[model samples]
Target chain A: MRRIKCTVQYDGTWYAGYQVQPNSKTIQGEIEKVLEKIHGKPIRISASGRTDAGVHAIGQVFHFDTDTKFPVEKWLPIFNSQLPNDIVVNHVEEVAGSFHSRFGSIEKEYQYKVYRGPHKSPFLIHHAYHVPHSLSVQKMEEASRYLLGTHDFTSFCSAKTEVEDKVRTIFTISMEEEENMLTFSLVGNGFLYNMVRIIIGVLIEVGQGKRAPIEVKEILEAKDRRAGGKTAPAQGLYLYRVKYSNDN
Target chain B: MRRIKCTVQYDGTWYAGYQVQPNSKTIQGEIEKVLEKIHGKPIRISASGRTDAGVHAIGQVFHFDTDTKFPVEKWLPIFNSQLPNDIVVNHVEEVAGSFHSRFGSIEKEYQYKVYRGPHKSPFLIHHAYHVPHSLSVQKMEEASRYLLGTHDFTSFCSAKTEVEDKVRTIFTISMEEEENMLTFSLVGNGFLYNMVRIIIGVLIEVGQGKRAPIEVKEILEAKDRRAGGKTAPAQGLYLYRVKYSNDN
Candidate 1:
């Protein structure tokens, strides 16, 4: 009975999401199927968090307990061989038995990518959200100031979210612009369902001058989903990193 | 009748190649199908050159004469709406009737991208060729100098090539390295079949220290296909630009 943690990366273009579902392909389902073949039993694994369909990940974390005799280094190549080309397991290591991939997490970082140009590029169609209009990065940054610190993010959450509590602390929200591409990175303790995408929608409005920067504070205080802008598409969002207390 | 010239871009992952073929999906076939739907008759388009299967293009030029009453600006969005997501027509204009896309071309620029890293990224799987070893860019550039100017490129062409003349003038061969990614850009008046890819395979060997830089001169003089290295894969090669005698 040893627990092992793995850092995973996936394209997420062909997945139904991270969670397992009937009659659908998923990131976790693919991993479990490979593990089931190796362990010769039904093996359950837990991820740091769930991502929506069409989203991507860079350093998503997961943990599973196994009694197999394989070494730690062999897990990466083995899992990669069995997994589809879209999903890849990067690194594997032995972790403490009490470690939980989700509950033990301290913070996470996410990025929403946007390509602002007149013509859409075929190469970037799968990985980025194309905006045919120019964006003001300074305006987006000003609006982001209202999203820092602990607050009830009800306005930024999905309308059909099942969670009761909506309070979360956003450590930072930063935007980087290079030519026609803009990337928004958000670091937070935890995020509500579809929170990042909804926040990005609001920021895009500010960047486009449809909404003022100071209006973000009003939306946050309103505590209603309708107070915010429409949710951005899922393909632009990515789970960039998951931070834990031990840095393992 | 208007001679419409369009700059096209494609992912090329799902197509047979750039040219039309029997019972095969191709870039030209798709464009002609869209034109046929617009004109109620079959249309033939001539591209600057043909690209192999799985080869991407950023600035591929093509021209077709059409009697349709649509404006130049409307052709882009109209053709885009009818075409698949993997292919796009970027710029469309009415060119001179005598401006042929293939015969009127003076030069072409192509690039081969390489990712020199230990890990393969899912995001870059379709765009870059991954080499998990150190490469000497200086050595590759040194070997490229031997391939410059007018020469017979028979040694660097495919064995299955049916072209009679092998004489072509290579304007330049330059290498640019950014972090672990290396790009080799080549400019030439014309190219033999599979010439750029075969030349890249020889450069890769020079970078890997498998062959000396001066050996490229001997191979070029041999004028035999067996005198060169293997033909590199098609995915990493991109048709970057095409220059015509006139601005049209």
Candidate 2:
């Protein structure tokens, strides 16, 4: 058996989410069904992480085992031909048997995009949130800095979360503003349920001057959901990438 | 009666186009039907230009005369409450009687976005065309420069074009690239049918080293449909804005 790792990019607007659900269309489920047909056998895929409904993914990594003798180049075009236009296979490569996409993931990064302007862009309306109010980028950066270390982010997690250990190591937290768009990029070892969205909600409040930079630190220490702002909308967030070391 | 000019934004993925057509779910038809229900009178809107099927618009200006004296401040919220989530009324304001959305336009601008990257961006999948091959941005820019200024763009016009006058004034043609995304911003007094799309087709050829920049001038001079490259896909193009000096 050969372990095949593939990088996929998909517009999650129509998908229920990354994981398979009962009678629901999902990004991973669609791709896996197509892969099963191509391989002429049942192929289960392991993804780097799961994204909520209406979210997007850029460099999402997945791996599956196949007994077929087909080459890497053939898998992409063949698999993509069967999949819908919304989901696309970017690259496919053969890796060692030990290469498990989810288990091997080290750091994952996500970006929450917001467009601050009088008018929402027709072109990017679905991909970003339209914020009528102005945001202080400097203040947002200061608030983001409070989230740059390892902490139990229970307060910033969604109430629906089932994860018991909320202690996750955040490698970097950066906010960038270009013209009318402001983006928050967060890299962490792992994210709990709705963690990124909740963090973004607090950051947006900081940017809007509704919450001070000090509130971010207080929210993390509180370990209570009420300490943070409401969960930001899901469509504004995107699973950017998943990193893996060479040994893995 | 009051004439209100509204700046509209739409995803266009579900829309047939901007115009109302028989047996078609169009942007105009959708908005008009909603207005007719709200106003208790048939309402027709005049738009700056007709966007092709699946082509999105950010600042698409449209005007309609209403007998009911509805305040401009509540116009957007009220109209948006009726409009589908795919189509949104971003802003609305009262315009002078002489201000016609289609006829009073001084200049119009469009943006055609193309992305050349190893991985397709899931977030940008709907808005931009993903061309995996590496492209020469300088070449595309050089070819685009030939399109600036007054020109008889008959060759660039669609073969099925209905407009007799192919002569149009291209005021500015600026091409800029950031990272993997290449954007062409074209501002013109008026456009021939499929003019911007065909221009982008030729520009893409230049970027791919398939055609020379000097060939662009020859294509324009030919004044025949076969002279220019194929029309660019509609999904990659967006009607960015329609300009009227008073509104901005």
Clashing pairs in 2: none
Task: Give interface RMSD for all predictions.
Answer: 1.1, 3.3
Tens digits of lDDT, candidate 2, A162-246: 7788899999988887888888899999898999999888888888999999989999999999888988888898889998887
lDDT of each: 0.92, 0.86
RMSD of 2: 2.8
Per-prediction DockQ scores? 0.71, 0.46
* Per-candidate total of colliding backbone pairs: 0, 0
Q: What residue runs in model 1 are displaced by over 4 Å at the alpha carbon? A: none
How far in Å is the alpha carbon of A159 misplaced in model 1? Answer: 2.5
Write the residue-wise lDDT of candidate 1 on A180-240 in tens digits. 7889999999999999999999999998999999999999999999999989999899999
Query: lDDT tens digits, residues B5-50, model 1?
Result: 9999999888999999999999999999999998899999999999
Chain A TM-score for candidate 2 is 0.95
Give the alpha carbon lDDT tens digit for every residue of B74-145 in model 2.
Answer: 788887778877788887888889999888998999998898877565566567887888778888778878
The best candidate in terms of DockQ: 1
